[model samples]
Target chain A: MIPAPVIAAFHPPRRTLLGPGPSDVSPQVLAAQSKPIIGHLDPLFVGMMDEVKALLQYAFQTRNEMTLAISAPGSAGMEACFVNLVEPGEKVIVCRNGVFGDRMRQNVERCGGIAVTVDHAWGEPVDPAAVAAALAAHPDARFLAFVHAETSTGALSDAKALCALAKQHQCLSIVDAVTSLGGVELRVDEWGIDAIYSGSQKCLSCVPGLAPVSFSAAAVAKIKQRKTPVQSWFLDQSLVMSYWSGGAKRAYHHTAPVNALYALHEALRMLANEGLEQAWARHKAMHLLLRNGLDALGVQFVVAEPYRLPQLNTVYIPPGIDDVAVRSRLLQQYNLEIGAGLGDFAGKAWRIGLMGYGARQENIALCLHALQQELSVVI
Target chain B: MIPAPVIAAFHPPRRTLLGPGPSDVSPQVLAAQSKPIIGHLDPLFVGMMDEVKALLQYAFQTRNEMTLAISAPGSAGMEACFVNLVEPGEKVIVCRNGVFGDRMRQNVERCGGIAVTVDHAWGEPVDPAAVAAALAAHPDARFLAFVHAETSTGALSDAKALCALAKQHQCLSIVDAVTSLGGVELRVDEWGIDAIYSGSQKCLSCVPGLAPVSFSAAAVAKIKQRKTPVQSWFLDQSLVMSYWSGGAKRAYHHTAPVNALYALHEALRMLANEGLEQAWARHKAMHLLLRNGLDALGVQFVVAEPYRLPQLNTVYIPPGIDDVAVRSRLLQQYNLEIGAGLGDFAGKAWRIGLMGYGARQENIALCLHALQQELSVVI
Candidate 1:
């Protein structure tokens, strides 16, 4: 028998989260998560789930009945959209500009579907003309997949134009709104996105576990007409729909994450109270404040202004600045947390976030001041 | 433009959770979950994750370095074990006695493996002799899968004996200890369990959504030598290991459920403080007290005494008693929650759980008194 190891109680530091995702969670949401545990099939909990779905629809600006939360993280939600929509031997036009787009390609390949890539620069939005060309070249492509707001590069692609192009080519669109939903202008119904997925921790400011997802009628019909069963049982949307659908009696899927759902409900409720458009405006306003301050510190953004995401701001590290040392000092002295660059831009860029509850004037001021202090010491 | 829907704040009712799973969580664990949200890749959070791994290792009674918590629920953990270990066209002997065992067959087939069944009666332990016979008949079997504690039927199988039989047949064993890990005796290393998965909501008294899993070196070797990639990308263990392994620089596999991990750390730490054997004894003693009180109320158990699990107790519904009415009344009047029968035994039995923090003398007394009062009203 293995002996028990001595461990201390985990007291997390009070951090001002300015990361790409998992931004500051509100106290109301955290307290909601601490509510007493209940059974997954409890009647009262089911009622709360219904409210969560309605709130998610409000956030995504869609009236689709199939909108609900997946019981895993955003990556699982991304996989759920691809594996359910694309069948074996089918072609999918996947636009690749940042990390999540490449992840979509991996999902397509794993599901035995061929991914036809439309490549662009890392910090640039996906080009609608290139996507149209790919769809034109591959007429048999059944789906088009792209990230609306790329978390890795802070680039905001034109989801509306891309979805329009997919519709023109008789293809369904799957949008990754992991960093876009509730932080920017996203109208799933207006943009004609057939399927989409977003994370709870990103713009929702909920404890990070659940992934909110939605599907239009076209996507549901495709799932129903699939020739083979989905390769994943846990991620099968058909089975999951029966459990989340409104009814007096719901069939049991896997056990729902009870407390996590509570947190999401509270988070979405707070968002609805604040209003989605107002939340977007707040993010943009905070971004401008941070931007002006960073510009004074000689920090230049990687993405061009028009295409940059207001929630996630990727900026180049100042020349001769020690990335590790400055970040460590900021964390140690100022209790500030900022994101490091991901993928190809590692050590060259830093991602500063103004998402959900983190998009406040106070948080922005502290982040800027902390960076100034840390840079002064390092340089 | 879509208008934001007005939603009320979610205020969950106080419930005394005594269900099949998601037993009553402790206040400490709940408060731990309410701690300020931190970045998943934060150095401090990484240090806490290391402690969580160590605590899980102590609870699982194994020194397997691959032990860590999955970012999703227990069903995902089950899928992870099967998808990672069983390759396409491989043969697995699945011992089916209850719901989770059938779920195992589904997971195996979804992973492109053939499941050869070794059937036993529900509410009874898995027949080790039958597993041996199946393994002997199918010499090409690569794995044996079964549940250590069947939550659906309240049956406790002999995990040590089952693992021994699998080892004798030169096959790896995948054990589901979801309801058994903290409440009973589980020596994974000594029992030779190759791969095991459990949930946080069961005997650990943690909130739902996280799954703790451990894999022996032999299981790791099998996954390493697999010919085909695992079908589910989110459930892949090899990619997850790099993030959970002890190191200064951990790869980013996925953004973990940060607050949920905090709850698990606290739950496991409580278990360590109480000592595993002491916990097992407490569960057994509480079960006996509940059994006597239930007997006075003329309740009959579904599973026989020897094979019955202490955490989950399945009892036959009294003649002329309405299952739904009684359970609904208990929840409405007493704020108590118990589980209804699932699958084959629906409406015929009630599952009364005495797991973790709920396995107390006071809870047992309250459950007995509440049931007696409700039965009197119904009759």
Candidate 2:
């Protein structure tokens, strides 16, 4: 028998979360999560789930009936859209600009779909002209996949323009709104996005477990008419729909993440209370405040202003500054956490997130002050 | 823009969860989950994650380094083990006795593996003789997959015996301990189990979402040397391990469910404090009390005494009783939730779970009293 190790109660240190994702969550959402654990199929919980769906629809700006949270993270949501919609040997045009875009290409290849690439530089938006060119060149492409907001580089592509191009080429569009959903303007119906997925942790400020996903009627129809079964049974929308869509007697797909849904519901309710336009404005305003402060500290943003994401602000580390040491000091000394850059910007940049609950003026002020103090010692 | 529906704050009803899974969570665990949100990669959170890993090691009775919680639920955990280990066209001997066993077969097939079947009656334990026969017949079978505790049937197969047989046949054992991990006697190292996955909600009494999975050295080796990449990118262990294992600077695979991990750590820590054997004895003793009370109510257990699981007690619906009406009354009036039968036993049996925090004498008394009151009017 393996002996139990003597471990103390884990009391996590409270830190202001200003990261690429998993931004600071509100006390209300945390309290909602801590409410009494109910059965997944309990009547009251189901009622709450319906409300969650409605709230998510409002957040995505879509009236589609297929909107519901995936049981995993945003990456799983990305995989779900591809595995369910892109069958084996189907050609999908994938736009590559940053880390998440590369992840989209990986998902396409793993699902046995050939990925036709349209490349753009990191810290830049997906060029609509390049996408149009790619779609025109590859007329056989059945789907176009791109990230609406690239978390790794804090770049926001023009999802509307990209979706229009997909439509022009007769290709269904799969959009990754993981970092863009509540923090930016995303109109699923208006943009004609066939499939879209977003994370609860980023802009929704819910805990980082659930992924809210929506499918257009076309996307749902494609799933229904797939010649082969969806490779991942856990993510198959066709089977999962029976559980999320139908009334009262929902089919058992997987045990719904009971408490996480509670948090999501509360987060989305909070988001609703603060109108989507208001939330977007708040994020943009906070980003500007942080930008002014950081500019005073000689910090330069990686992305151009027009394509930069308000929620995720990617800035280059100044010369002679050690990336790990500054982030470590900020976390340890100031009890503040900012995300390190990912992919191409790993050691070269830092991502300062002002997402949802973290978008307040105080958080941005605190983050800028902490960074200034930490970087002063190094730079 | 879609109009936001006005929704009230969700106040989940207080429930005595006595269901097949998602047993009553402790107030301590719930409180732990409400702690301040931290970044998934924050140093303190990473330190807590290490502690969680250590506590999980105590719970699984193994020192395997590959043990970590999947961000999704148990079904995804089941899929993770299958997709990572079983390659296309690979033959795996799948033991079927209940709903979860059938799910294992689904996972195998979804991963492009052929599932060789060994069947047992729904409420019966997996037949070791049949398994041995199948292994002998299919010498090329690389994996033996079975559920140790079938949640749907309230049956506990002999995991030690099953794993030993798989060892003798040179097949790596994949055990589904979703309901068995903390409720029963499970020794991963001693039993020679290779890959094991479990749900946090069942015996662990944590909020539902995370699936704790562990891989033995052989299982890890097999995954590392796979001819093809795992089909599901989200469930891929090879990439996930880089994030979970090794030193301080861990790779970023996915943003983990921070609050849920807090709950799991507390739940596992509580289990460690209680001691595994003591926990097993507590579940067994509570089951006995529940059994006596249920017996007084004229309830007949479906599984034989030796094979019956202490945590999930499956009993036949007495003749002429309305399953829906009785369960509904119990839920509506008593604020109690019990699982209706699943798979073949739907509407024919009731699964009374006395799991983890729900396995107290008072809970047992309340469930029996509630059932008696509801049944009197219906029967």
Candidate 3:
């Protein structure tokens, strides 16, 4: 028998999280999460879910009726899109510019689909020309999967152009907007994006866990025509559709993370209150503000200005500085949290996020001050 | 284009959730959820995760090193165990007694495993003798999967006896403890349950969405010898092991639902404080109290007394009463939520849950008072 460890209740310090994702959550959203517990199937909660769907459509700028939050994180959302649309033995042209793209390939393979990859350098956006080449090479490919905003590298690819390429090739486009949705300009219906998924923690600034996803009519038709049932029952959109849709008389698919959805609803409400364009502009403006300060500190950005994502800012750690020490001191001394680079860039770069509630003047000033103090000790 | 619908901020009523699951979460757990968001990879957060693991081990009453909470609901947790352990073309002996047991069959098939089902009546527990017969008939079966407590029918099965049957037949046991965990007597190591999954929203009294699961060392060994990669990248425990295990230097798996985890940590801590057996006895005592009151109201239990679940109390809706009307009145007029019968029992029964914090005297009295008033109008 394992004895229960004598541990005190955990009280997490309120660190200023300026990481790659889970940037900063507002107290408003946090409070909504803490509000009295309600049933997932409660009619009132269902009404709130309807509002959540409408608000999500507004954020995504889509008219797709098949839009709702996946009950898990963005990774599950990515899997949902792939498993539903990419059936076994079907070829998918996956574009890999960073970590999430590689993950997409893994999703395709796990779903028994062959992934024909088009590789690009990390910290660089997906090139439409390279994708066009891939599509031409694999003429039978059914789906074109790519990440719009690579959280690993802070690079924002041209999603509109990429979707057009997929359309030209008669391929459904499955896009990962996990870090792009509210912070960047995304037009799902306008750009004819077939399927897309994003996270609540990134630009939405909700507590992490839920993933908002949208599927176009064409994508839904493909799902209905699937030769095999979606491999993962939990991620199957066809079954989940009955639960998240169907107005008030929805069937029980899975017990939703109810309180987490409450937080997401409030986060989306706040996103709507600040117009979509306004939120994107704020993210861009904050990115500029942070960049100006970093320039003075001689910090170089990993992604070029034209391709950089406003919500996520990746920069090279200085030659003389210790990566973990600077980050450790920032956290211990100033209650700050910034992301370490992932995958290929691990230990070499720092990803500083200026996401939804975190894109503010005060946060920028604090991050700059903390970095300067820590870096000066070594420089 | 779907124009953004202008909706007011949602304020969910402080509901007394007496449903099959998603029982009323305590104010303390709710308050913990609303605390400041932390980075998933932060040192402090990682420290808290270790505590969560220890607390979960104590809650499961096991020293299984492969114990952790899945980022999604219990369904995903069920999927995780199946996908990791049951390889393609393997035969699993699945027992169908209620809704979840059927879901397990679906999970088994989705994992490319053939399911040999042993059927029992919905309100009846899995007969150990019947399970033993199935094992004797299917000597080549690699696993036996069954529900420890049928949430749909409020029937508690003999997990210890059934696990012993599986052991005698050289098969691993996969048990669904979604409604049984803290509300009943469950000793994972002692019972020799190879794999088990439970929901947080039930007896744990936490908010819905996270699923706590544990796998014995034998089960882990089976997973290690699997031929195919787990069908789901997100649910792949092999990869998730590096993230939840490995002490301070845990690898990044997914952007964890950081805030939801804060709530789980607190819920587990509360369970540890209360003592597991004490929680079980309290549930039994509360069940008896509700049963006496329910009897006076002429309510009839669906499950036999010997097999009834203390946490979930399923009863037939009195004849000649509109099932929808009574439940609707209870929710609308009295701000109470009780579960409607699901699957085979839909429109024919009512499931009055006394789960977790909702199992107390005040909640029992309130539920009983509300039920009497609603039934009086019809009777």
Candidate 4:
């Protein structure tokens, strides 16, 4: 037997999360997680699960009965949509503008679907014209998948346009709203999204782990038409829905992450209380605050103004600035965390986030002042 | 667009968790989850991630380098092992004695692996002799999978012997340690377990949603030699290891469940401090306490004493007793949760769990008293 290693209790220091995700969680949501855990199948827990489903529908602006939280993060939720809706040998057209867009192509291929890529440069939105062209070319494509907001580049694609194109082509739409959900204007029903997934930590002011997802009636129809069972037993939406969908009886799926759901419930409750439109407006206001300050500091944005995501701001590092050193110092000295550029943008840009509870005047002012002092020292 | 649903914040009433899983979490572990949220990629959070790996190693008693927690629940962890190591068309021997064991068969089938079943009665332990016979019968089988502790039936199969039989047959062993990890004697290295997956909610006294998994070098070699990519992108261990493995640079895979991981780390730390042997002994001691009390109440155990698990005790519902009424009243009136029988045992048995923090003298006393009163009323 290996001797037990004595480890101390992990006590994390307070950090101001201005990074791409896991933005500052409200104390209410955080405290909710510590509340006593109940059985996943308990009558009370089942009641709460119903509320969660209704609230998620509101958050996504959809009336889809298939709305529920996946037991894992956004990635698993993304996989759930693909594995359930897309069969082997099926064709899927994926828009690749950033890291998550590329990930969508991977999900397609992993599940034995053929993926045709529609490429866009980082820091730019998925071009609707290019999507239209791709859809026209791949008329047999069963699905069109893309990221609504590219977290890696702070680019906001026109989801409404993309979904409309998918509809015109008679293909189901799969959208990754991981970084978009509560921070901007997104209506799953109105925009005609077939299947969509979002993270709990990104714009919900909840801790990471749970992924909120919804599927339109069309998406459910596609899943039901599949001749083969879903490839992933854990992510099989048909089985998972038996537990999350309010049926006469709840069957045992995997044990739901009880405490994490508590946090998500509190986060969604707060979002509804604040109202979705108001939250989106607040995110835009905070982005403007940070944007003006960055302009005064001589830092340029990576994305064009009209295409940018208010919650995720990508800006170029000042010439001759050490990317790692600046981020390190900010973390150590100011207890502030900003995201280093990801994928194609690595080491060339920085991502500052204004999400959920973190989208406040105080957070924006602190971030602007910190960058000003750091850049001056480097110069 | 769906209107926002005005839902109040969920405040779960304090309940003593004694069900099959999601056992009573320690206040310390619960409080750790509520600590200020940190960035998933934060330097400090990464440091804590290292501690979690080490603490998990102690809990599983394995020195395997492939140890890490899946961001989802144990079901995902189970799928991770199968999708990574079990290639399409490969033959695998699965010992089916309970729900989890049958689930393992489903995983193998979903991955396109042929599963050879070795059947056992629901309440009985997996007979090693039968496993050996199955292994000999299926010489081309590349893997042997079974549940270490069957949560559905409270049957404790001899994992060490089963793993040895697999080794003798030139087959790798995969174990479901969901209910066994911290509560029973599990030595992943000594027993030659090629792959193992466990749950946080079962015996770690942590919140549900994270699955701790480890792979032996042979298992890693099998994964590396896979002719085809893992079917599920989200559960793919090779890509996931790039983010989890202790390498010079951590790659971003998915957002780590930040707060949920904190709870896991704290739970594991407490396990290490208590010492694994001591925890095992305590579970045994508490099991005997509950066993004697149940006997005095004329309750008979589902599994024989030799094969029964200490953490989870399955007892046949006394004749003339109503299964749902007793469990419902226990949940609604006493706020004490005991599991209803699962699978074949449904409506005939009750699973009373004395797992992790819930394995206490007080819990045993209350459960016996409540069952006694309820049984008399039914009579």
Candidate 5:
């Protein structure tokens, strides 16, 4: 009954979404975005959900029994993983090298778990030695939390080494692979990661909304034996499991965003066809292209070569140049979008993402030319 | 890059989305849904955000300075309202008439607030006199929380009377108008409601991923003076406001669901064209038509006429009838979706939603015919 208003559509100049995450969506994914929304539990939608889960498993390299998409964005995925796995009064060893790691600490604390933080410099990955030392120090720790790829600083951590450290201390490991899953090599099972969560954006190239999460058999058992009920009834795995895992007769949680799921399924299907290793290699190759361009323009990377993520490249701002103004000009003039540094490096660094569909050589060339023009004004 | 899949051009089915919500999206809104994704802070997107705020103000009948859509769903909106308003040790009077009200109570408790509940029968509206009495008894209560419309039971509460009572007692009112919004007449300013939240589904007829929320100046002041920090950094209104409010420069909160906002903007535009009063009348008339059809069959309404919501209609299931079987038949054969009764009313009731585009005459005829065919054996 709503009368149609003559509100005009506000179309931004077609910019490459080359940010830390939510990279440029493929035309097919964008078309999937317009699919008719069906009921969350509609048989057709449920079929789509099953396919999404299967594709997510392929990307994460995990055979975990509890693999599904959280209804909210990546942040809620972090909350769900921590709140469901970390019980009240439990001690959690959280490794913090960047913003996402700090987010993990916040999640653990909000869940009433005492956070034992192992702090690292912003651009550095979580050192396995430091994580092992922290695990040894906190003998009563129930979980070890770390980010696999630090989106804020483009640092890629050694997830396998950290998981091994947690295993040595008899602690379940929770991994935040929000910016990792498809762009990098992540073998959840081989690395002994008990719990992991990822975003649909970033290398997955899906529009941002759902969070793909997985829990190993050990983590599910821990949830099963929890002494008290989870505070967040909405995000509780036990309740969510009935809806996500049970076939045919799924319980109602919240209304799933049916169209978004269709898009995610399409994006994941695209990933499946690309082959996980091939996708990872493609991302790395694209990163090299971007790196070469930036280096040619005298822009050095913030993170060293060996540790940096291929998708998210953090670079220090040149001395005396206004970061915001340069980014603004690039956006307004050339229709290019890049990321500003987060937290401590806020005014000092710029993050250029060569991710997913935005990772094409054409986009890299376009960005280089645009940045060169925009930076000439300030530099 | 995502591998190209064979993407069929989107031509959504013209079904009546009449279950709980995502009530028939209009063609205009569907077209809006396909608009290209833009950066969350793109100037054009920011301008669109302004229009969205203005439209929301019209829909909620408010002039509150803090009004914006949460990037997540209705549940997240519920969480935001609680996390920001009800700090630990605060006392909140929660009126529980149905499922969503119970959910509010859960949020309050999880936020470490003391929830003093005013109970009502599932199919009945909340008693304003009871709420007044509770407010009088708990004079120290900081807020009164209640649902304006109970979607699960198809009941409409006296939101104006309840808000008046809360104001008289010098307490803030946190209202859940998720189901009532657009379908029911709500005057946020006239009712003196301090804080209110709504969903994108229901009468809005958009998708389900966004929640529109608003806060009065008084409510904003209360939040500004809170002693303890909000537990959820993400949902904290203070943080979200910097991005949502049209300040000089928007602070980054999280990536806004770009294309989804386009769909919501289009829905609001439609609402703006159709005066709110006219829209309300349309919903009422549609409900009347649906009632006539239901009466022609052997079905009886679970919620009585006086308190019934025109948008959601709960009907009693006859004895010996298989509720699941009938719902399955409706979905499989008719491709028509209706809601199963929630909580204690499960298997006892079927909720038929006459909302937005789903409230048309053809939809009513289709729904009635489908129900008649399925219920003939049981009745």
Candidate 6:
């Protein structure tokens, strides 16, 4: 609405996205991003939604009947899962190692649920034995929540074992695969994950708008039996299903991000063509290439090798090297985007991502070369 | 991740968006919708954000500063305003005549604020006398909230009067201009509206992902003085302001819907070129044409003419007519989109909208002709 006379320059940098997310978007995906906006209930857009659901099912290795993208980001996805499953006064065992886990605790407490948190060091995997001990101690806990890949520290948790432990304790399993889906192995159904959420910006290489989520039959059944209604109308899946499900008469929910779904559909199609397992291998291979370059430059990873996420590699900034200065130079000079460490690790480490379409050898080399130049100037 | 073999069709209907919103998008806007994705904080993208803020200020008719779009839809905008302004135990005087006003009451209670509601009849304009009485009754009320153009009932309330009442009573005002703004006359500065929220899909004719919002200086001051943190980290405007304000070192917020902003910019540009007064005239002109057609066809309006919205027209479904049957036929046969009545008025009315780019003489004729044909079959 500003006068056209005052319209400023909208020159976006053509940077190589090598951060936790969003990964570099493919041209095809980017083209899809700008598809004409359509009504959410338009037959064609609904078809696209149906396709996205199927693609997400394949990506998560799940046959769960309920699957769709929430219209907001990954945090909304986290909120959706908890608000639907955790009723007031319920006990939820939250596994905390990084920022996202702490977010889970916040969500639980906000919903009036008691969070029985099992803490682990940041940059370390969730301790399955400790989870088992907690489950043993608190048999009444209704759900076990954990992040599959903690973007904050680049650590991958034992999602399968954690789900198993939740099942043993008769608790539902909620997993945050925001930075893991398609980049790593995520067998939602096979691993017995009851409810899961993922971000489009990460391994999907789509713009960050929609959050793909799935609820297992058991999870749905639990929701159906809930004594209290979902507190947040925006995040309520019960009302959401009437709109997202396969039905003759779809109900009105909040409007969906129509064009963003087109981009997501394209990205998921690209992932489907490459195959999930092959994509995971590609991410792992590129991570190794980036790690080798960083190691050769005398950089140390914040997360230990065994549990490091291929998509996000967290590296410690050497003593006396300015974290902000190195990142600024990377952006200003090389047009390379990388993430700063979050929360406790802020100013101490850098997060370099090799994810989805960005997991190519060329991008890895470019990122490393840029980082080396920037680090040398700063150090 | 669906099998690459299952390719879905991307069919988009050319809807003459005559309902509540998701108005007809222009070819230029549609083309902008398809722009390539970029990092949210990319210099160019940040520049766009600044332009968008300026444009939003123009559309809202306000220059009080702190205007930006929340990444989610208009409902989220409502959430952002209430969550930031109304902390636990504060009192808010909400005037409820239709769905959005009821939603405001719900949000106030959910945010732990005491909601003092002034109820008006469905399909009727919010009564200023009732609002003034409520304000007088609840002298300690922190804010007054109401919908400017009620999408449910197609009633345009006296926003200027409401805001004046709020100011006189020493309380701020929250306005839902979702179906107003580009479609009708709104002067945030003249009206003294404190916090206003609108939808991208409505009069703006942009895709539905972002919610345009603006905070007055008084509202921002109230936010800063709040004792508790905004419950929603993603919607906390204090953090969001850093990313939206075109400062030298913009802080990193969540990744915005990058490509959607392109479409919005283009839409706003189109609006600017047309001029606000001209656009309002066009909407009124088209509405008059459509109203003539409806009156000729013996269709009575749900909302009385004097208080009715020029953009959205709510009409009673003739007795013995099936509302769903008529709408379904219109969708299948003419590919036209119109909205059904919401909340208490459901099954009684149909909402026909004439908004933004959708408010064309040709589109109005097409919608009227389509409705007449559908009605003959049902009636």
Poorly placed runs, candidate 1 (over 4 Å)? A377-379, B377-379
DockQ of each: 0.82, 0.88, 0.81, 0.88, 0.36, 0.41
User: On a 0 to 100 scale, what is the lDDT of residue B48 in model 3?
Assistant: 87
- Model 3, residue B365: distance off in Å is 1.0
As for candidate 1, its clashing pairs are none
Candidate 4 displacement at residue A302 in angstroms: 0.7
- Chain A TM-score, prediction 1: 0.99
* Tens-place lDDT digits, model 2, residues B1-379: 7888999999888889898988999999999999998888887788889998999888999989999999999999999999999999999999999999999999899889999989999999999999999999999999999999999999999999999999999999999999998999999988899999999999999999999999999999999999999988899998898888746879999999999999999999999999999999999999999999888888899999999999999999998888998888888988889999999999999999989999998888889888888667644
- Candidate 2 has an lDDT of 0.92
TM-score per model (chain B): 0.99, 0.99, 0.98, 0.99, 0.95, 0.97
What does candidate 5's lDDT look like per residue over A1-379, in tens digits?
A: 2223356655545778787877888988878767767777777777667777777777778777799988778887888898788888999999999988888998888778899999999999899988887887889998999999999999999998999989999999999999998888889899999999988778888888888999999999999999976767568789889988888888887777777777888888788877888888998999988888888878879888899899999999987788888888888777788988899889999998877777788988888888887666555
* lDDT winner between candidates 4 and 5: 4
Model 6 per-residue lDDT at B63: 88
Candidate 6 on A195-238: residue-level lDDT in tens?
A: 99998999999878889999999999999999976766677798
TM-score of each: 0.99, 0.99, 0.99, 0.99, 0.94, 0.92
Error of 5 at A240 (Å): 2.0
TM accuracy, model 4: 0.99
Q: Backbone clashes per model, in order?
A: 0, 0, 0, 0, 2, 8
- For model 2, give the interface RMSD: 0.8
Candidate 3 local lDDT, A1-379, one digit each (tens): 4666788877888789899978789999998889898898999988889889989999999989999999999999999999899989999999999999999999999999999999999998999999999999889999999999999999999999999999999999999999999999999999999999999999999988999999999999999998898889899898998988978679999998999988899999898888898899999999999999999999999999999998899999999888998899899989999999999999999999999999999999999999988888655
Residue A206 error, candidate 4, Å: 0.6
Please give the lDDT score at residue A369 for candidate 3. Answer: 92
Evaluate residue A27 in candidate 1 and report its C-alpha lDDT on the 0 to 100 scale: 89
lDDT tens digits, residue span B23-74, model 4: 9998999999899988888877888898899999889899999999999999
